[model samples]
Target: LWLPGMGAAYATAAPADPVPWRAILASWTASHVAHAVDAAAERLQADGKRAHSSQRLTQARLRQTLQRAESARTVRERRSGERQRLLAAHAAWREETHQP
Candidate 1:
């Protein structure tokens, strides 16, 4: 009689229900989804930074090219003005010397 009661007590002490499989699967799926979303957001942020840097570099190069063009124009104007002055001096000298 004491043995039967001891077996009955042991049986009641432990659970009879098995472990749930669906709960485990659901938890794993949710974790993966969250991880993927975070990775995509990080990638998008990096791409935006790269795009901003590229635009700044392009603008700087454009400004540099414009400055060079302006400098070239000033140099050409000075050279043209000097050439005109030299021509005028030569003409005046020729008038005074009078080659016959």
Candidate 2:
């Protein structure tokens, strides 16, 4: 296999700046931790977006329900008024027909 830092005679590292094992391990650990933090942040952001959407949907449903209730109340009031009018008419007719 053709390795970048190896020579034809022996397989040895030949980087101009020799890095200690501790330094290499520390850098690797830091890189992994940074990646983990970034992943967690992304998940948190997605969760926030989902929560916002859920709140909006819930509010919209509540508004629709409120509107329906109001409309039902209006219809009920109108029907009640009609019944009162009919009762008044019936009373007037009774008085006129059965005159004392």
Candidate 3:
């Protein structure tokens, strides 16, 4: 006789929703803020000489560098996530279409 708990498990349904943009933006901003702090520290160590506009330029440069890096990273992550979702959808579609 077949055991009650030995049957095949049912496939779980996918969620009917998309990624939240606001959440993504918040994450991107928070990551950049952290990077900015690191940039400031690096600038302080690299230059012992201080000019008239040294502090202002350093802050500006740090913010710019952090912004660019964060933007690129965010884009890459979003694209990677999109690719994963597309692959999953394709697989599910194939399975569903071929089922009896």
The lDDT leader among the candidates is 2
The regions of model 3 sitting more than 4 angstroms off are: 1-50
- Cα RMSD (Å) per model? 12.3, 6.6, 39.6
lDDT of 2 by residue, 17-85 (tens): 364444445555566678899999999999999999999999999999999999999999999999999
TM-score of 2: 0.74
Query: Candidates' TM-scores?
Result: 0.71, 0.74, 0.44
lDDT tens readout by residue for model 1, 8-62:
3444433543633343444455656788999999999999999999999999999
Which model is ahead, 2 or 3, in terms of lDDT?
Answer: 2
- Residue-by-residue lDDT tens digits, candidate 3, 72-92: 999999999999999999889
Per-residue lDDT value at 36 in model 1: 90
Superposed by TM-score, candidate 2 places the C-alpha of residue 93 at a distance from the truth, in angstroms, of 1.7
- Could you tally the backbone clashes for each prediction? 0, 0, 0
Q: Name the TM-score of candidate 1.
A: 0.71
